[model samples]
Target: MAIPKVFITRRLPEKCIKPLQQVAEVKMWSEEYKPVPREVLLQEVQTSHGLLTMLSDRVDETLLAQAPQLKCVANLAVGYDNIDLEACRLHHVIPCNTPDVLTETTADLVFALLMASGRRLIEANDYLKQGKWQEWGPFLMAGADIHHKTIGIVGMGRIGTAVARRAQGFAMNVIYHNRRRNVEAESELGARFCGFESLLETADFVVNLIPYTETTKGLFNQNAFTKMKKTALFINAGRGATVDEDALYQALLEGEIAGAGLDVFSQEPIPKEHPLLTLEQVVALPHIGSASVETRKQMISLCCKNLMRTLAGEKPITPIETSR
Candidate 1:
């Protein structure tokens, strides 16, 4: 049998690349850290049977049209918003994503961002670096308390449950709002289901873990921020489009909320002059939710496994439902 041609968008770890190369003719785009350009991607896909893509790549109808031979697309990340599933269906292509493997790692990042924002960790470090911290005063670098506070979690999925489990150590009360309440979550995590309005109004720390969908786009707007307490801290480790960036800027500037910790944003590599970058109360990171060395390797391995399975005439390990 002829070997299937596989195209990897970015250079993955050697271990991950080796397995795929053993079974297929693999061509890597070479640069491990940056996204591959659209023209190059379209050209490469024309002859490829499988594509291992990252979240940064936008796999739309036009791109799919170029790859009539493409059988499967395995995304390295859990979020597949970058891929247009409808187009993939029309093209008779299977789309897969690495999901469960990175859930805990991403949850850990959410907590780290939450603590950094609530305790003003970034601002205090900058203060010391700038020689502004002469002596520790009673009121110096004071910030919101995280322990024993009410935590409102939006989108109570696997990651949200993981976060709630961690919060148990702090003896924090966990209340969550989901599209539909999970009875198992309530019994297992000691989480109480609440309405969206109540969650925003009552939580001391509002953590967003929802996926990007038609209903969830721009869910956190000016009105949602206004419902939060002046001392409440907002943390998002979820998709960037879930929050309105302009509204978030205005909310922080006007003291609608105390602070924000954002790992994901509406734009990746947000411009230096972006208003959110100028605020001391907001902590932003370059979208590294599942960035732990071990977790990333596992994610790549899973993506490779999915692609290999589909190409070998077996079912994908983690196939996404096209109907949803």
Candidate 2:
């Protein structure tokens, strides 16, 4: 019998790929930064039994139809929004995502972004680097205070709950809104479940950790921003499409909200000419929420394990429920 073949969309650290190599013939795109071209991915999947994909790769009906032998798709990130799970289901291919492993790591970033935006750390750094600090003034670079403030978290999932735990350390009050209430977070973390509009109205820091779905797309719009405290700081570590970028820009421009720290955008590799980047009040990061070395390696390993197990006719460790 021919050995099962697996294709990895991007070049990963050799150590993480080694275990999979032992189980199947492994092929990887040579470039680390560049995504595999669509043509290349389609061509390679024609002969592949499994695939390890990045969020940048689109695993839709188009790709699925070409991949006749594909048994599994192990997405490298926790969110499987990039993959067409329904398509995978119809094709009888299991879809897996790296979850739980990066929850805390991503939570750490959410808190950091919250702090950076509240304190204007990025702006201050730029001011000093630009040689604008001629004298120390009491009001110079004054920013929002995080301690003892109310933090409203949208989406009380693994990462959201992890962020609530961190909020406890700083003595901040936590309030959350989810599709359904998370009673554990309410009892253990002292989080209060509130209506979405009320959370927007009250939180000193509105931290968006909601995922992207048709329902959540553009959930944070102009009205949502207007509902927030004029002094509020917004932090988005969630899927970018959850916010209307144009509306967010207008909000900051008109002082509907104070500032924002963003780790993701509606578009990946957000163009340099994007209007949001022009705002000094906005601190933008390149979707590095789970970028810590230790956590990233763990995510990669989990993806490898999922792919290996599925190709071997075993259940995946974290299969996504496509029906939802």
Listed in order, each prediction's TM-score against the native is: 0.98, 0.99
All models: lDDT?
A: 0.92, 0.95
Expressed as tens digits, the lDDT of each residue in 241-324 for candidate 2 is 999999999999999999999999999999999999999999999999999999989999999999988988899899899885
The prediction achieving the highest lDDT against the true structure is: 2
Compose the digit string of candidate 1's lDDT tens values, residues 1-324. 889999999987777678888998999998977889889999999999999998899999999999988999999888999999989988989999998999999989989899999999999999999999888899899998889999999989889999999999898999999988878889987999999999999999999999998899999999999999999999999899999989999999999999999999888877889999999999999999999999998998998899899999999999887774
Which segments of candidate 2 are over 4 A away from where they belong?
A: none
Model 1 whole-model lDDT (C-alpha atoms): 0.92
Displacement of residue 209 (Cα, Å) in model 1 is: 1.0
Q: How many Å off is the CA of 161 in candidate 1?
A: 0.5
Model 2 scores worst on lDDT over the 10 consecutive residues at 315-324
RMSD of 2: 0.7
